[model samples]
Target: MDVRELRNCFGRFATGVTVVTWKTDDHEYNGITVNSFTSVSLDPALVLVSIDKKAKACQALENRPFVVNILASNQEPIAWQFAGRPQEKLTLEWEETEVGPKIAGAIATIECIPWNAYEGGDHILFVGEIKAFSYNDKDALMFFKGKFINN
Candidate 1:
């Protein structure tokens, strides 16, 4: 079985793009673009995001609070920045939350406190208890077949 082919098959499912953000102890803000976020439960208000084992955020988010910034359609630049192709002159307006910082213009922001973790192949599934959430009326940024689309 080809792993690349498996990845491509998985990519066929459309998902909303998100920037999983957390602040370091030294006050530095960090983020990574992810499309593997999902709602887990309602009674406990749970959510989850998967981070690759080798990704820096996998370490940064350990036992720490984080914010899920659901990208808006026009926020492709921000997504590219966190996805590793950072722009030379990227300017972002940040909204500081108890958990971390989020892009001010995100379609929605979910503030969460670390709840649970589990290993899944090359990724670690991090679950969070929703502490707070906010949203705006706007189109979402979506990922499908390895491309970004506005929806």
Candidate 2:
């Protein structure tokens, strides 16, 4: 299928907005936008995030731990900022946790260590072992079709 058709098909499923972030050599690299995140297991606290094989962040995730910033409804701008405007000069505040760094104003933040990885068509599935979690009581930022919406 073509890109638009594929996107339209995938858009049927609404998903929460997430910014999957990782650090390397004292510098932070982030994906800004991701919806391919889900809980996998409760026994081992495993979560999976599917990253495009060609995405810059995929390279870092191959061998490094990262942070999953689950955006709060109020943080929609943060989602857009990370999604396509990384250099837009927006102020981002975050705190450090046992596993990694997390966005300060996010609805929920998960710190994960890369536990497993596998190729899936055009994406790489990064299974992460949850080390810690935190949350702020608020609505979530969601995405549908080609726009950002509230959930």
Candidate 2 local lDDT, 1-151, one digit each (tens): 5989988999988899998877766665455478899999998999999988888778877878888888987777788777676546678887766666678888888888989999999999999998888887899988888788876
Clashing pairs in 2: 32-82
Model 1 over residues 1-151: C-alpha lDDT tens digits? Answer: 9999999999999999999998999998889999999999999999999999999889889999999999999998899999999887889889898778988899999999999999999999999999999998999999999999976
lDDT of 1: 0.94
* Candidate 1: segments with Cα more than 4 A from true spot: none
Candidate with the greatest lDDT versus the true structure = 1
Local distance difference test values of all predictions, in order: 0.94, 0.82
Query: For model 2, what is the error of residue 85's alpha carbon versus the real structure, in angstroms, after optimal superposition?
Result: 1.8
For residue 97, give model 1's deviation from the true position in Å. 1.2
